[model samples]
Target: MKKIAVVAANGRVANKVITEAVSRGFDVTGFGRKENNTKAQHYVQKDLFDLTSEDLKGFDAVVDAFGAWTEETLPQHSTSLKHLCDILSGTDTRLLIVGGAGSLYVNKEHTATVMEGPDFPDAFKPLASAMGKALGELRERKDVKWTYISPAGDFQADGERTGKYLLGGEELTLNDRGESVISYADYAIAMVDEIEKGNHIQQRISVVRA
Candidate 1:
């Protein structure tokens, strides 16, 4: 069985991803601020800033479901990512980040990202902007295998797993109703699928319902 490490494993998205990965027979180690409430083989309660490469060694891949909930802690996103990259530099473990959709282009021209558009919620800009900065740093690294997975504009936790979704490039995807949306469950499916397939390498990919 493939061994995987999941950071922030108690978060909604990470919880779903952990469930999916475990269901697929993968051996998983979950790390969270508190005791992991998931069904993984092992659970480690530790701060992301405290994680050392030794703690993450031996996993086939690491899924970063880490996020900042307040403006005061937004910088942790970038800091933690850098720490992970620095420690995993020469290792074979792949890093898969659950990213924000705000960084995705709203049009094919790529002149503007969704976060800069008029429709983006002002209240969420700080969070989106922080995520954008972190993603920018990830794109510049070439030492370790990293893939950033951005969900659609409407990523929700309560939606069902329809077992269907569409993958896009840097562009934000829209459905027949012209809505960009995806359930956390389906997003987890895509994430675990990518973990197993390794189709995307050092790239930013987006997901939405077909």
Candidate 2:
């Protein structure tokens, strides 16, 4: 079985992803800041900043579900990502990030990103900008095996898992209903599929419900 470690495993998306991965028979270890009843093979209580290479040596992949909401904590996005990259710098372990949709381009021409668009909520700009900056730095790293998965515009926490989704490049994806959304459960399917196939390595991909 593949060994997978999910950081921030208690999160809504990460929790569903862990359940999906475990259901598929992957050996998963959930890492969190404190005691958590996560559905995984094992649980580790540690801070993201304190993770070392030796502690994560055998995992096939590490899912980064880290998020920062407040203004002061927003910069932690870049810091946390860089810290993970440093630890897994030379190893073969893949870093699968649950990324923000804000950074996704609004069109194929790459005219403007969602964060740059006028309709984006002002409340979310700081968070999106921070994640975008981290993504920018992530693209510069050639040593680490990373795949950033950006969910659709409406990342519904209460959304259902229909086991179907469409994958796209950097542009935002809109369905026939003119909706850009994907549930945490369905996104997990796409994430695990990428883990199994290893296609689109070192790339940023988006997922929207089919």
Which digits, one per residue and each the tens of the lDDT, describe model 2 over residues 1-210? 899999988888899889999999999999899788789989999999988998789999999999889988998999999999999999999999999999999877887899999899999898899999999999999999999999999998989889999998899998888889999899999999988988877999999999
lDDT on C-alpha atoms for all candidate structures: 0.93, 0.93
TM per prediction: 0.97, 0.98
N/CA/C clash count, model 1: 0
Superposed by TM-score, candidate 1 places the C-alpha of residue 161 at a distance from the truth, in angstroms, of: 0.5
lDDT of 1 by residue, 47-132 (tens): 87799989999999999999996989998889989998998898899999999998999778988999999999999999999999
Runs in model 1 deviating more than 4 A are none
